[model samples]
Target: MNAPEAVNETDAALLAHAQRLTAQAGRPAPKALTRLAGGRNNQVYRLEADDGPLVLKRYFTDARDSRDRLGAEWSFISHAWSRGIRAVPEPLACDRAEQAGLYSFIEGRKLTAAELTPGHVEAAIEFVLAVNARPRPALAPGSEACFSLAEHIATVERRVARLATLDSEVPHVAEARQLVSAQLQPTWAAVKAGILSGASAEGLALDAAISADQNCLSPSDFGFHNALIDDAGKLTFLDFEYAGRDDPAKLVSDFFCQPEVPVPLAVHEHFIERLTQGLGLDAASVARCRLLLDAYQIKWTCIILNDFLPLGAARRAFADTGAWAERCAAQLAKAEAKLELVGADDTP
Candidate 1:
């Protein structure tokens, strides 16, 4: 679908406002401008100013907490940069009042479904492995807690429960409830068991603990569409709106969730190998991480079935209830296959 039209703001007005903000930061206004890709959620544009080629990202709605969002993004991009991850754009300035920001625009093609071939997956995997190598910095003093898969599960459960109570005749609502009920329990059990058995639980005592320590930051929305690849084949990650502290397994699950890319079992194995090697994780830990990845993938699939897919053509495409159930069943079957392999290898 095409992006919603952005509000008409004149170049002169935007430039003047941008100039004032840049001046405050000891920089100059952009010399030229061009509208970039606009998405359903945000308006992105390119600013060719005296300073250099920069990007302007403007929010279409005020529902978001722009201040905290920008702060989190800035922290993530800066931290990832320091750790030698070349998957982020450089943030130059932010104006929370205007709900806009300026950043260094990397030259590259926006990765599409077709472009995410085997080679692209390998490169993207390496980039993420590098980014997840270090611990995420503490959220800014007053910022919100970083996003979490466990928290997301809780939210989905609540939403699904609410949907169940609503009138049963609502299209896909009943099917959504059935899907969540059938899938959530076993999936969450696998994740919990994996975490408890892994080395990451030695110090953490929480019932739903995914990691003993939250050391890595994950782009909660990591996908091919959010990646930009340059001529040199280097990938740069963008869209930090959902960036937050998370377990590495969740990040891997996010990558595998891309509908266009069929991530084979070998891809998963290679990803874990690279990740653990890069992060210096032990073999046992990697095994446990594999199980957790499977669990997270199931949970993520349930989320898509319940929320985004229920209201649109996704429902018809998958067939109302039976097809949706089959999809979840298929995911669980694949997950079980992977888990079986993990279990077999872990056997003494």
Candidate 2:
């Protein structure tokens, strides 16, 4: 990623937008606006003001994918704040017209896989439980939230189908095409079959949706990947763009399946039991999580290869100005590694 062009903290339009939002929030104009990295779908910056530090974020907008990222994140954080959840940022101000929002800056570093400890895992579990302690009407279902096994399978199938459309002569694209056709497609077929068959064996209906009470507030892309450890050793979760009501099973699956800052599989059982027991989830929900792990694993493989798609490439380009061929090749390798985790039999 090229910081000069990609972030461009000096960009007049962005600075103007930030100034407007900060002024509206009753703060001194930022003496310095520094762009922050780690955001893949939006622009984030740290603003230093006379009072303190604040964060300004510009949500990504595209005709092809419109999910109201700004609204979702603002509403989710507001809800958590209202419930006395301090593990999230304070929602300070928003400029919907600018597709931007301002929040309390978090001084922290992204948690890495190597630094993960059981205490950290417990903190994450507690955070989820606290967030879901009660429900509110303001929140909507999470982006692409699936209620049934059939819906989950359909979502993955659609992603795989999109990847199958790759038909280019470029070296990286050509290699991706072969991987999709030979590995991804066949792996998805097997995973789909296994999920359907396993659901039947477990007496879980593929089309039947779980009751509303079973739904939990999910940080859609939940994982250590989205968490930061502050200077004081408190963990603060970020990126609620896809946060809202979702199947707890899906949340659990994504927690373990997310590749970045991967949570250790050794804690999988403890994590599941603690979350289920705390949230009062039924045994069937636990079974669903276990049975659906492979499906999610396959889904993540398709997600990792998104660099080959038009919209995916566009998002990547916006976030990181890397060479296309290099990124595509790296993503293909990641997808292959993720695919290998599908049947490693570590499902919780």
Candidate 3:
């Protein structure tokens, strides 16, 4: 299928713009241009440069604040490169004024649902392990991860409370409110207990803890979909919009939650093993990381239900709020089981 039309600007116009920008930088005009197929947050295009190929990312400028995220993306990709993490595309240049940037286009096959096989799972785990091995890069003086566990939990609690108050107006609001209220308190309690008990201390000791890493560089979003496999079958990761110093456990948690795979307990164990091997983490530290991962997953699920599910845009999906609640409950139960297993292990 032909790529979607460039939404913000016509292709001819964007091509002309790219030509001007490249010429200004003393580079030749691109040979070909085509829109890329992922991401709802940014406009991406593949530009075939004279030397080879480069990916052009134009930041959404409709909102004043939306344009500001480019700087963070630049900081992340550059820092990751310095630390030898290949999880990010090689950023070439960023023009904040133009609200656009360029990076090397990794040549690989985009991962689809069918590709989420056992072999692919092993590959994905290895890639994440390599990323986690590196120390998280320090955030710029005042920069922070988008959210923290404490803050996130508070937001969920507040939203759930608001839903409770709106129950009479919305049809399923009461059910969602109850579903959220029932779990909010215990989930928050578990998070607090985990934090106070130092269950998440090892990889989360920095200022932002898992939210922001001190020396470790993390991709803002790491999932099977964002990863690609080259002809050689090696994994090449892309997308750095959410890349920053985050809790290693959070990264693992996001991976486990990816829709592309069914996260069985064995898969989690394999991830820990490969991650430790790739990142040079000790066994004890890996076990500790696993606990933090379970905690982070539960925290994320709560955010999805209490926040996203209640929003007008997402309410339709919760038409059967009872069903949604059951699924969330099931996932939580699994997470709890994993937590118990990892928490009881004496290795870490």
Overall lDDT per candidate, in order of appearance = 0.56, 0.83, 0.55
Q: How much is the lDDT of residue 162 in candidate 1?
A: 43
Q: Candidates sorted by TM-score, descending order?
A: 2, 1, 3
lDDT (Cα, tens digit) per residue for candidate 2, span 1-348: 112233455677777777888888888888668777666788788887889988888888889997999999999899889899999989989998878999998767888898998999999999999888865554798987988888888888888899878636333888888888999899889988888888889999888888887788888899988887977789998999999888888898899899988887767778889988888888778888888887888888888887777787678767664566776778889888898887775644
TM-scores for candidates 1 onward, in order: 0.64, 0.94, 0.62
Clashes in each model (backbone N, CA, C under 3 Å)?
5, 0, 12
* Per-candidate alpha-carbon RMSD to the true structure: 7.8, 2.3, 7.5
Query: How good is model 1 by TM-score?
Result: 0.64
Task: Kindly list the per-residue Cα lDDT of model 3 for residues 121-158, writing each as its tens digit.
Answer: 77666655555554444554222232344443344345
Best by TM-score: 2
| lDDT for predicted candidate 2 compared with the true structure | 0.83
Candidate 1: the clashing residue pairs are 30-49, 31-49, 31-50, 87-237, 135-215
